[model samples]
Target: MIIVVDALNRHLFSDILAEMHALRARVFADRLGWEVTVKNGMEIDEFDALNPAHVICLDDDGDVVGCMRLLQTTGPHMLADVFYDILDGEPPLRSSRIWEATRFCVDTEKLKGRTTRNSISYVTSEVMIGAFEYARDAGVLDAVAVIDPVMNRVMQRSRNAPYDYLGTPKQMGKVKAMAALMDCSEERIAGIRDFAGINHDVFGSDDEVLSLFKENNGSAGNGSREITLESAYDFAPEPEAVRKPTRKDLREYCEAQVASAANDEEKVAALALKLELAEILRGDVQNRCDA
Candidate 1:
C-alpha cells in the first residue's frame, strides 16, 4: 500500500522514510549517476528542508519499494532553482495550482522487472496512482516532472503521457533530461489504474498506518525485528479491531514513553508525539468519557 506522509506526520513514519532515502541514494546517485548529496547513506537535498509531501509505496512486507516527492510550484523547486537551465530560453512554469514531482524512483534492484505498462507491477502503478490522487485531492491541477528519456517513455506506456514539454531534452549526467507536464485529474489517475488493473484504494487510513508502524520496530540500519515502541513503552500495539484507544490509554502510553526515555531529547519527542496522539484519539476519548 501507499502512504502519504507530510511534515506533521513524518516523524511517525521514520522507518519508512529512512528506507526511502537510502533507496533514493541508490537510484539517483549510484545508478542514475546524478550529482546529489548523499550524507550518512541518505539522498537528501535542500528541497527536503521544505518538507514536501512524500507518496511512498510499501510492499506487502511493509518495506518501502517506490517513492515520489511532491512540492508546490509556487515555491522553490528543482526546475526553478537547479534545472532551470534545461528550460532553455522559455520562462519557468510557476503556478499555485501546480506542483513539482521529483525524485520519482522505485526499488528497481528488488523489483528487477522493467516497469512498463505491459508489466503488471503493483508497486509501480500504485505509486503513480498514489501521487496523482494526492495532488488532485490537495487542489493541485497539474505537475511538472523532470525525467530522463527512458522514464518519459515508461510514463507514456503507462497511459499518462505528458501533455507538454518545457524544452528540448538535454544531456544531464549520464542521460538526457527534460521537464514534462502531467495533469493531475481523476481521468489521469483512472487511466493509470486501468493499465495496471488495480481498482481499489491504495492508501490505508491514518490510524491503520500508525498501527502498522507501531508493529514494525526495526531500527534504521539493522533489519533485526526488535519491538522498539513496545519494549520502550511496555505495552502491546493497539490492536486493529479490538477497540479504539481512550484518552486515558493514550495518556498512559505517553507517560510510559516519557518515563522510559533515556534522555531529555527522547522525552521531549515522546511528549510531542503524545500531544499529536491526543488529538487523534480525541473522539475515542470523548466516547469513553461519555460512556
Candidate 2:
C-alpha cells in the first residue's frame, strides 16, 4: 500500500474532509459501535477548521483505505476543548508548547492479516515523523497526545522509547486512556539526523522533518501503546556538523518566539531566559557582523 501525505489546503480540503468523514463513520459507527450520527455523510466539528491539519491517504489498489488528522496546538485545542475533563482541568496545557495529536482511523478490511500490526506501525511512524517536522518549523517545542493504552504501548515500542510521558495514563473508556506530552528536544533532533544519514535517500531531505509533524498531528495523541526512547544520544550527529547561529539571527528568532507567546506570565518568564540567550548570541553576531 502506498501512503500519500498532503497538507490540508484549499486544493485538497474537500477530498480530505470527505475521507475523514468516511473513515470516522466506518471506525466509530461500524467497528467501535459508537453512538455518533453521520450527517451529510460527514463527521466534523469546530476543531476541524482550527489550526493547520494534515491528512494521510492510503492507496490500496487505487482505493483510499486508511487516513488520520493532525492539528497543531495554536489556540483552543483538544486539551482545553475535548480532553479537559480527563485532565481534571489542571493540566499545564494553557502555557505549554505542545501540539495536539488526534483523530486516527484505519481501514481494517484492507489490512486484515498477520502483518496488520506492522503495517499500522509503519504508517504511524510516518505520521509521527510528519508531526515532528510540522512542530519544528512552527516553533512548537513539544507535543501532547491522548491515546488508547494499547495503541500507546504500540507507539512506545515502535519508537523504541523515543519519548517521555508528562502525565499518567487517564483511562476514559474501556480500551482508551488520555495522556500528554512527548520529547522533541535537540537530542531527539540529533537522533533523527543520524537515522537519515545511512538511509538518506529513503527519508528524503532534512526538511522532511517538518512534514512528520504535520502528518502525525492527528494520530500523535490518540490511543496507542506507550513507548520511550532508551537514550537520547543513540544517534550520531550529521557529518557536515551543525553551525552555531549568529547572535543577531538568534536574537531575531528569540524575539519572534517571545512575541508569539500568549499572555501567560509563567510562559513569558520562561521565554525571557531563552530571549536572553538569544541576545547574548546576537551580541556575538554583532561583533562579527561589524568586524
Candidate 3:
C-alpha cells in the first residue's frame, strides 16, 4: 500500500515517517555509502525541511519498504542546490508544472524474496505509479529525478521510462547522477500498471494506512533474514477481486486529472481516459435514468 505524507497530514504519520527516514539511512548511508547525514539511525537532510510530499510504500506488516520524495521545482530542490554539478553549468529548470523527485529507495532485506507483489520490482512500480498519479492529479506536468544508471534501466524495465533527460551524467560519490524527465500522464501510469500487473488503485486510504502503522509501530525489528514477501503477506490461493470504483468516483477523478493537465499531450491523454471511462459507464447512466 502507498501512503503519501506531506505537510497537510504529516502529524498523523510521524511514526511511519520516522521509519522511512531510518530505511533511508540504511539504504543511502550504510548500503550505498553516501556522505549523507545520519543521526540516531535516521538519515535526514535540509531538503526534508522543505515540506516535500513523501510517497511511501508499506509492507503487509506496515513497515516502510519503499519511498520517494517530491518537491515543486519552482522552489528550492536538490537538482537546483545540492546536485547543481549535473546541470553542466546550466541553470536549473524551474516551473510550477514540474516537480523534483528524489531519495527513491527500497528495503532489499525486508522485501527479499521471489518476484511477487512485495518484490523490489513490484514495490518500485507501486511507488512510481503513486508518485506520478498523485502529482498528475495536483497539476504537475513533469518530474525530474536525479537517478543513477541502474535506476534509469529499472525505470525502463518497469515501463516508466523517462521521455527526456537534462544535462549529462556526472559522477556523484559511488554513482553517476543524471537528471531524467518523465511526463505525468495516463499513458505513463497505464504502462506501469500493465508491466506490474497492478490494475487497482495504488493509494491506500488514510484510515487503513494509519491502522496498519498503529498495529506494527511497536514491533521490534529483527535482523535481516531470507524470507519471501508472499509468505509474509500470506498470499491467497487466488488473487482477490479488485473493487471497481463507482461511476461517480471515476468521473470526479477524470475531471481532476483533466483539469490538472499541464500541456497539450497531457490534456489529450486525460481526455482520452475520460472518454474510455465514459464508454465503460454509459450503461450505469442509462440504468439510473430509467429507474
Candidate 4:
C-alpha cells in the first residue's frame, strides 16, 4: 500500500517517515554502498527538510518496503546539485512540472519471496506505479530519476520503461547510474497496471492507514504484523467484548486511571478510560439496569 507524506501532513506520519529513512539508509548506504550521509541509521538529507512529498510503500505488516522521494526540480534536487555532473555540463533542467525523483529504493532481500508478475517482487513495481500515479494526479508533467541498470531493467520488465535518457550513465560505486525520464500520463499508468496485473487502486484504504499508525503505537519492531485483541486497544477484563460503561463505572474508571498515572499521561489515560468505559456501558446497559 502507498502512503503519501507531504509538508502539510508530514507530522501525521512520523513513524512511517522514520522507518522510511531507515530503509533508505539500508538500501542506499549499506546495500548499494552509496556515499550518502547517515545519522542514527537514517538517510535523511536536506531535501527531506524541504518537505517534498514521499510515496512510501508499506508491506502487509505496515513496514516501509519501498519508497521514492519527490522534489521540485526548481529547488535543490540532486539533478541540479549532486548529479549535475551527469548532465554533461549543458544545464540542469528546471521546471515546476518536471520533478526530480530520488532515493528510489526497496527492501529486495526482505521481500524476496513476495509474489509479483514476471517473477519479480511486487514492492518495486508497486512503488514505481504509485510514484507515477501520485505525480500524475498532482499535475506533474514528467519525472527524472537517477537509477542503475538493475532498476532500469526492472522498470522495463514492468512495462513502465523510461521514455529517454539524460547525458550518460556514470560510475556510482559498483553500479552504473543514469538519469532516465518518464512521463506522468495515462498511458504510462495503464501499462504499468497491466504488467503488474493490478486492476484496482494501488493505495490502501482509510481503515488500513489508520490500522498502520495504531499498530505502530501498539507494538514495537513489528510493523507488518496484525494487531491482536490481546495487544492493541484492549484492556478488557475478560475474553468477551467490552460494553458501554455505566455512569458510576465510568467515573470510577476515570478516577482509577488518573490516580495510576503520575505525569501528563494521566490526562491521556483519563480520556482513554472514558472511551473504554463508554464502550462497556454501551454494551452492557440492559444487563446493568436489570441487575
Candidate 5:
C-alpha cells in the first residue's frame, strides 16, 4: 500500500519517515555514491526542511520499502536550488501547477529477488503510481524529476517515461543527471497501472496507515530486525535497568549491521561493534558457567 505524507500529517508517520531517510542513505549516499548528507544513518537535505509531501510505499509487513519526495516548484526546490546546472543555463521552471520529484529509492536489500509484491519492480511502480496520482489530484499539471540515464530507461520500460527533456545532461557525481518532464495526466497513470497490473486503489486510509505503526510500536519494530551502530546506541539499556537484551538479540543485531553496512567505513564500524558485543557476550557466558 501507499501513503501520502505531508507536513500536516507528517507527525503521524515519524517511524515511516525515519525508515525512508535511512533507505535514502543506503541508496544514494552508500550505493550510488552520491554526495549527500547522511547523519546518523539518515539522508536529509535542506529541501526536506520545506515540508514536501512524501509518497511512501509500504510492503505487506508495513515496512517503508520505497519512497519519493515531492516539492512544489513555485518555491525553493532541488531543480532550482541544487540541480540548476542541469538546466543548461536556462531558468528553472517555476509554477504552482508543477512539482519536482526527487530522492526516489527502494529498499533493495530487503525487497530482493521476489518477482512480485516486495520486489524492486513492484515497489518502483507503486511509488511512481502513488506520486503521480497524488500530485494530479492536487491540481499539479506536471512533475519534473532529476534522474540519470538508467532511471530514465527504467521509466521508459515501465510505461511511465517522461514526455520531454528540459536540458542537456550533465555529469553529477557518478552518473549523468538530466531534467525530465512528466505530465500528471490520467493517460500516463493508466499506462503505468496497466504495465504494473495494479488495479486497486494504492492510497491507504488514515485508520489503516495508523494501524500499521501501532503494530510496529507493540513489537520490537524494524529496529530489531535490522540494526546499525547508530541504532545500537539508541536501543541500549538504561543504567538502572535490570534486564539486558538476549544473546540472540545481540547476535542478530551485530550480524545484520555487518551484512547491511553501506560503505567501508560503516562496515568497519559494524565489525568493531560486533567484536565488542561478542566479547561482552563471552564474558557473560563465562560468568554463568563459573557460577
Candidate 6:
C-alpha cells in the first residue's frame, strides 16, 4: 500500500472528512460498540475544525483506505480535555515547544496489520512524522502525546528511548501511558522510520534526518529527556509542598478555555498563555528542589 500524508485542504477536505467518519464508525461505533455521534456517517467534533491536522491516505488502487488526525499542543486537544482525567495535572499546553498528537483512527476494515509493521509499527507513525515536520516548519519545539503502552513502545523505538517513564504506565481501558518528547535525535528518527518500514529515500540521509530531529529538539540538550513524574517529584521545586494538578482540574481548565475563546487567535493566544503559566509553575516548583 502506498501511504500518502497530506494536510487537509478544501479540495480533499470533504473526502478526508468522510474517510475519518467512516473509520471512526467502524472502529468506535460498529466494532467497539461505542455510541458516537455520526452525521451522515462522519464522526467529527469541534476539535476537528479547530486544530491543524494531517490525514494518512492509503493509495491502494487509487483509494484512501486509512487515516488519522493530529493536534498540536498549541490547540485544544484530547490530552488537555477528554483524557485529562487520566493525568496528574494540567498538561503543558500552548507551547511553541510542544505539540499533542490526537484523534488517531484507522480504517481497520480497509487496511489490517499495518500497525504490526516491523519498521513502522503502525500507520500512525507516518502521520506522526508528518506532524513532526508540520510542527518543525511551524517552529514547534516538543511533541507530547498520551499513548498506549504498546504505542509507547513504538515511540520509544522512534526516539531511541529519549523519554523516561513519566509515571508508571496507567491503564485507561487499555494500557495507556503519559509520555513527552523532551528531545529527539537522528538515531531516533532513523529508528522510527526503520520501524515503520518507510523508505529511507523519502526521509533522506541519516544526517539530514538527524538534522530534522535536532532542529525539533531545540537548544541542544534542551531536547534531552529530563523532567519526568519520577524525577519531577524527586527534584521538584517544592518536593514537600507541591501537589500535582488533578485530572479534573486540568479538564475544567481546558474546557473553560475552549469555551471562552471567541476566535482562533484567542484560542491560540490563550493556550500560549496557559503554557507560559504551566512552565512558570513547574519551574517555581522545581526551583525549590535541591537538584
lDDT of each: 0.75, 0.51, 0.82, 0.74, 0.81, 0.51
Q: How accurate is candidate 6 locally (lDDT)?
A: 0.51
Per-residue alpha-carbon lDDT of candidate 6 for residues 1-291, written as tens digits (9 for 90 to 100): 322233434232333334445566567667756555555445555455543455444332223344555566544565655565555553445544566665565555555543343122355565555555555656565666666666666556665453643333555653455655534344445565676777532333334423433454342412233332222223313322323455445555555675567699989977886677678767977988846
List candidate 6 segments past 4 Å from native.
Answer: 1-8, 33-35, 113-124, 154-171, 174-185, 200-291
Pairwise TM-score winner, candidates 2 and 5: 5
Clashes of each: 0, 43, 0, 12, 0, 18
Clashes of 3: 0
Q: All candidates: CA RMSD in angstroms? A: 17.2, 16.0, 16.4, 20.7, 19.5, 16.5
Which prediction has more favorable TM-score, 1 or 6?
1
- List model 5 lDDT by residue over 159-226, tens digit each: 99999998899998778999999999999999999998999998899778767755755443445435
- Per-residue lDDT tens digits for candidate 3, residues 1-291, read 999999999877767777788899899999999998776677777667767899999978788999999998755678877787998876677667889999999999888884778798899999999999999999898999999999999999888999999989999987899999999999999999999999998889998898877777643332232332213223222222222345554666677668777799998998998899888678778999999
Which portions of model 2 miss their true places by more than 4 Å? 1-8, 35-37, 60-62, 114-118, 160-162, 166-168, 185-291
Q: Name the runs in model 5 displaced over 4 angstroms.
A: 216-291
Candidate 4 matches the true fold with a TM-score of: 0.72
Off-target runs (Cα >4 Å) in candidate 3 are 219-291
As a TM-score, model 6 comes out at 0.56
Worst 10 residues of 5 by lDDT: 235-244
* TM-score on alpha carbons, each prediction: 0.71, 0.57, 0.75, 0.72, 0.75, 0.56
TM accuracy, model 3: 0.75
Clashes by residue pair, model 1? none
- Order of quality (TM-score): 3, 5, 4, 1, 2, 6
lDDT of 2 by residue, 1-291 (tens): 223344434342333335555567778777877655555444454555443464454432323445555565435565555555666544335333666767666666665562532354444444455556556666677777777776666655554242655445565655556665666665554454343332222232323422433355342321131221111112223222323334444454455556655678846875876867968767988999999
